[model samples]
Target: MMTISSSTFLMAVVACLLSPAVQALGVLPHTATRTPSSSSSSLFMVGRASADADFAKAPLTQDDQAVDPNVYNVNDLELAAQLWQVSLSSKTNQPNRPANTPFLDTKPFLPKDPTTKYVVDNVVVQVSRTGGLGMQLWELAGGRDDGCGITLIEGVSGNAEAAGVLPGDSLARIQYTTSMQGTQSSTTATEMDVAQAITTLNCECRDFDATMEVLTSLPPPEVVDTLTLTLKRLRTWPQIDVVVE
Candidate 1:
């Protein structure tokens, strides 16, 4: 019944606040059970775990699915206009090209070596020159470069380029039918015969000997009415790839 000491009174107050009944009554804050530093650390850990879970599942979200991560099909016209992927070597070449390029019946015939030199006509065009055929010819033996053919060394479009001829081209077959006028034929021919007959004669590019004969027998380009050369072109093309989105 006497007055209590200040220390004893303080102990009683602390015990009451920690009691289950007082805690349930909401006398103290709910976090009061743990130390301040421990409670703050535990909340931070829970927030980090939630963030990690959300990050792990982020790929399945809606906005991330809008863009495609695969290659476009070459024939997919709807996705974009004609795009070209030019390549130097056939190993990396693709048949697709821009619309401006003429539509070819056959795929591009890229010459990787002598065996692949001859094929379909890639670019069909006629070239004409007046004087000085502007070319040098060398006889290649069969054992020299896999086989034999007449190849031009130095020339340009203005001179020896009649019938789409170009430098570094090996003569394949000659067209003796077409001329500046039209289709023409030969019955019999000699050096004294008409120039038309001489031009219409069959080409002699069959073998090295025959090719040499034809080369030696050629009248001047100014004398012939028409000339068409079939050559296997070997040149290097630059590597360029274009993509239109």
Candidate 2:
């Protein structure tokens, strides 16, 4: 695989990645408890995966947590990977947001084999309005005209590292709750799909300017408060599922 490191353009694809093993592994809804973040700008639920159920729910406000990871084979990875990836968003009207079918447009970006699976991990992190995400991203292209791409995290720090976000993990979705002005302060989740961000920018001109605009449209480091991230890592097992949430 060809991986290039850059903080320049960070984007990825969102796909309705489903397979047999993935279907069998069903979704286990996780209940998260919200706590005050470092900046106190907002409260969010943060945790890390461990053998113990309680340990997996430790808040990021804490320095650390008990660790006893469960050993797993390739098949087991296929099973637990469903722990993160869930579904796609159908809401629209967000500027430059792709349609629900963009999930299909991203299919070519996957491996030629239909059965390849990935380990999808849901990690919650806090984004500072000033300090930024404090991480470097590796932009990966799938050699498609659809503008579909991938983002791999590196140089981790800030809440990302605290949440156990590892390098080489593919970023899928960034979800944050924000209050709307006219909506009576009603809160709604604002999500940024790394994959769809780049794809939506592909129109008449696929030139450098359009590419830079894609970068600009991304969820900048200035986005504050707590964010839940959907991350994907390649799995070695065959006949498994590929998840993108």
In candidate 2, what residue range of length 10 has the lowest lDDT sum? 66-75
Report, for every candidate in turn, its global Cα lDDT versus the true structure.
Answer: 0.28, 0.34
In model 2, what are the clashing residue pairs, if there are any? 12-194, 12-195, 13-195
lDDT string for model 1 (1-245, tens) is 23221111000000001011211211111121211000000011112234558656333223332322111111121111111111233342345433333221212333343222111222222323233343434332223332332322223333333333333333443333322433344653432332334242232123344444454454444444334544433222222245555
Q: Which sections of candidate 1 miss by over 4 Å?
A: 1-130, 143-158, 161-164, 178-209, 216-224, 235-245
Model 2 stretches with alpha carbons more than 4 Å out: 1-130, 182-215, 218-224, 234-245
> Evaluated with TM-score, which candidate comes out highest?
2
In model 2, what is the error at residue 223, expressed in angstroms?
7.6
The residue-level lDDT of candidate 2 at 127 comes to 35
Clash count, predicted structure 1: 0
Identify the candidate with maximal lDDT: 2
lDDT of 2 by residue, 82-150 (tens): 222222458764465554533211221134554443333233343333333434444333335654544
